[model samples]
Target: MNQTIVPDSQARGLLARLPATPRALALLARFDRPIGWWLLFWPGAWAVALAGGGVVRWALIGWLLLGAIAMRGAGCVFNDIVDRDLDAKVARTAARPLASGAMAVKVAWAWLLALCLIGLIVLLQLHLYAQVVALASLALVAAYPFMKRITGWPQIWLGLVFSWAALVGWSEVAGSLTLPGLLLYAGTIFWVVGYDTIYAMQDREDDALIGIGSSALSMGRHVRMGVMLCYLAALGLWGGALWVVRPQILALAALLPIAVHLGWQVITLKEDGIDPLAKFRSNRFAGLLVFCACIVVGNA
Candidate 1:
């Protein structure tokens, strides 16, 4: 039952082949993990589809995609910089560039600044209203790294931070937020909370030892149930969002597949053998499914 990806020898071989600075920097940014961008991009897409009447906005979408990539990297770098000591103690994150001393803190901060500058450039392409909504997320992003230290619901904070793009996207398309947009944003928050809590489960043991807080620890023996509730709430809110936009039976029908898929995830989830990273990564597909539902309902 060697279910672990990148076995010890393979991991060692991969590390040996990696170049010094650039490769380490890429790893730190998690360029290898496209899931981050996918997660980030979805909220933007959701907003565009809902607000733009399901017509894709290619230019805005492209810019938002780039912004997501850069900002997610910046966020990761900042988190790593702040959590270097804690990352060093965690088996899964011990090899991170900051934690392993492959990159200096000052260098990491400089990299973060560069990425944020790029993100800001992308942000400026949007309307002034969208710009304000986008910039307002900075405080949430700033406070997120410290959340695990203070509350067992750090994933909740992460949901707020990660899904802020929904508001930005809606504002970019509509020039202002609407009730539908707000509902979509709320749904996305619950979605993030559910998936990220699943992700936190992978480091639950280490997190507990080091005094970190996560929904995984809070749920304790009922982690699966907690995830189910979170997922259900997400679905309910998304359905509500769609209802606000279009009250037809077809609009509700569009969500059925997504609901079934989420149910499958809940039923098939192996809480004991759960690989949090994989579970977290799986959310990209979940997001896509819901995005498709939104597009269909909105277009109809």
Candidate 2:
């Protein structure tokens, strides 16, 4: 019997129309899944918007979008390279180009370099302080693929890696990090932890068998509550970020929409089947809600 490989539902779309090798390479980089970039882009957008640069620094937002796409793709490619063997053991990840042997490791490395080149262009567009802050994340990014092997809370490292854009965006717009930026970064970290934990639920059994750690497995039966707490913490920190900028009681209300949306996720969360994946992907919209709030508060 042949091993049947399964990919996540989001793995289809435009990339499906490409030639075999290129398609495989695109899958390796997760280009078909725009949500990854969207989630990565939002915290940076939140920072830019909250710094009152939503209109004045429109070009910077554009640059952050490009950087997010490139960097997120690069991260996925690097992760696939590192986890190819481990990926083969997970049903949802087993069809990944590297895991399935559809792409060579060397070719994947080249693709990773190509994505980094695009990231480098975006980096050059940032100011010195933001550039240094951004460079510091490379070490974190490099360390992330191994965290699952050593710790159950790998999502914490991912939060640190993914929320880094908040620092870069704040530094670029405000010329340095401050209370608002730090709070935004901290809040975004909890947001990442919440969503990634939902994502991890899909692989719990495989992760257990493979002897890897994940927040989903660690939270166990309390996964929904765990996610709820993470979301609550994210809102609190984000609310603080808004308060630091505007200081009005009404400013704190800016977070209400995202707060409601996150609450909906927890209330509707189901630990089985595709529910976790759906909730995980819903954060893209949640990110937008927060961005809108940032715009309202920052521009007010």
Superposed model 1: Cα runs more than 4 Å off: 1-18, 273-275
Model 2 C-alpha lDDT per residue in residues 179-242, reported as the tens digit of each score: 9999999999999999999999989999999999999999999998999999999999999999
Model 1 C-alpha RMSD vs. true structure (Å) is 3.6
Q: Clash pairs of candidate 1?
A: none
Q: Give the number of the best model, judged by lDDT.
A: 2
Candidate 1 local lDDT, 30-141, one digit each (tens): 7667788889889988888877545668788889899999999999998998898998898878877788777888888888898999998998899899999999999999
**Model 2 alpha-carbon drift over 4 Å, by segment:** 1-6, 9-13
TM-score, model 1 to reference: 0.93
Error of 2 at 210 (Å): 0.6
Q: Clashes per prediction?
A: 0, 0
